[model samples]
Target: MITVDFSLFPVGPGDRVLDLGCGGGRHAFEVYRRGADIVAFDQNENDLAEVADMFAAMRAAGEAPAESEAAAETVTGDALDTPFGDDSFDRVIASEIFEHIPHDTAAMAELHRVLRPGGIAAVTVPSWLPERLCWALSEDYHTNEGGHVRIYTRAELEAKLKAAGFLIGPHHHAHALHAPYWWIKCAVGTSNEDHPLASAYHRMLVWDMMKAPKTTRTTERLLNPLIGKSVVVYLRKPHRGSAESTG
Candidate 1:
């Protein structure tokens, strides 16, 4: 499911977009469909391969706009040092990615470097309380090789982004219903696929995502501000004139 709100960080046809750490290419696909030139950047070759295939499929199926100049590609690289030139992308999306990076400051700097002046970025991380519950529930959840390394409070994240030269904007929480499902998984076992309760909860979540019934949508909207599992922060790179003044 998509985590970043497009309304808050709107993109247009031919806008250059980067989906950093694009695991499974969910956000990248959405950007492509919106007619942006999208690069799905990830370290996993297999995941990139799948994302590339999906891009081709979308093109073949005529999912992208005919008059739109959108193009899709995949790039495998380090987040701390992507290969793009400075001021490259018009927009960037980094969802549920920072918590896994050890050198988050460097990665943030890279994100800042690649985005053009006045460009917008949307960053999402695991919210503090729900993530803490997950870590408390299971050692396996955070201890794995690529698992989340830390939970972030909103303040900590905003500070880091500002330090990286981004001007922070309004933020919001998302995916309120996901917190409890993850808590159950962590409590039972991270890999306990056979657990009945966890399986049932997973199925329910899948249904909610696929069908998006009015009741569940309204419930999630009401619950989002209170206990959303992901906190999304929007940031903008200052224009050169404002950059000098802010500096």
Candidate 2:
């Protein structure tokens, strides 16, 4: 499911987008379908291989618009030191990734460096309350290797982004319906995949994704502001000579 609201951070034909730490390429595929050149970057070789395969599959299935010039590629790299040159992309997406990086400021700086002035970066992280509940429920939830290393309050996230030279823009919460499912998992042991309640919740989520019944959709929208599991913020690197840029 998407955490970023495209209405606030639109991508279109010819736009070059970077999906940083693209674990399974969900957002990358969306960008490609929207007719933007997309690079799905992650450190995992196997994940990148699968993302590459999916790009081919998407092209073969004619997923992009007929006249679209969008291209898709996968890159394996470090977020702190990406391979692309400075000011390379029109938009960048860093979804649910900052929590896992120890040097998040450096990574944020890199995000600012690669984005063209006035370009947008859509960043997401676990919302503080839900994430705090998970941590309180189980040690494994955050302590696992490569798992979330810190919890982010929205104010802290915005402050760090501002320190990295980005002007914070609109923000919102998303995926409210999924918060309880994770809480259940944390309660039952994060690795216990066979717990009946967790299993039931998983099925329900999959069903909700496939069908998107109005009842659940409406409920999620209502609940998103209060308890959404993920919080997404859009930020812009200021253009040169602008007041926001100089100050």
Candidate 3:
């Protein structure tokens, strides 16, 4: 499921976008469909291979605007040490990645260095309360390898971004329904897929994502502010001669 809202970080034709830590390439695919040149950068070679295949499939299917300058590619690399030149991308997406990084500050700095002046970065992480609940419910949830290493409070997230030289912008919560689902999984056993409650919840979530019925949509909207699973923050690099840049 996509976490970053496009309204907060709009991409259009000819925009060069980087989906850092692209994982399964969900956001990168969306960026491509929006007519932006997208690079799905991840450390996993297998994942990048799949992402590259999807890009080819998307091109054949005419998913992106034919007349636009949209293109898609996959890059495998370390987030702390990306191979991009300075100010290479017009927009950057760092969704659901910071929590997994031990050197998040370095990664954030790389994000700032690669994005063009005034370019936007859309970052998402597990929200405080829901994530805390998960941790409290099960040690396995956070302790697993390649899993979330730290929980981010909104203030801390903004502070880190500011320290990285990004101008913080609007913030919002998403996926309220998924919060309870994760809590249930933590309560029962993180890996126990066949547990009745966990399985039922998974089915509901899959249905909600695929069908997007009005009932769940409205319910999530109402509940998001209080218990959303993910919080998305938009940030921008200061333009040349702006206050942050000049300093």
Instruction: Write the residue-wise lDDT of candidate 2 on 1-247 in tens digits.
Output: 9888999989999799999999999999898899899999999999999999988888889986553477788999999999999999999999999999999999999999999998999999999999999999999999889999999999999999999989988899999999999999999999899999999999999999999999999999999999999999999999987657322
lDDT of 3 at 241: 81
Which segments of model 3 are wrong by more than 4 Å?
66-68, 244-247
Clashes of 1: 0
What TM-score do all the candidates reach, one by one? Answer: 0.96, 0.97, 0.96
| Model 3 lDDT tens row, 92-174 | 99999999999999999999999999899999999999999999999999999999999999999999999999988889999
Q: Itemize residue pairs with steric clashes in candidate 1.
A: none
Of the candidates numbered 1 and 2, which has the greater lDDT value? 2
True-structure lDDT of candidate 1: 0.92
Off by over 4 Å in 1: 66-68, 243-247
Each prediction's whole-model lDDT (CA): 0.92, 0.93, 0.93
What is the lDDT for 163 in model 1?
A: 93
Q: Residue-wise lDDT of candidate 1 within 1-247, one digit each (tens)?
A: 9898999989878699999999999999899888888999999999999999988888889987553477788999999989999999999999999999999989999999999998999999999999999999999999999999888999999999999999998899999999999999999998999899999999999999999999999999999998899999999999987843222
The positional error of residue 58 in candidate 3, measured at the CA in angstroms, is 1.3
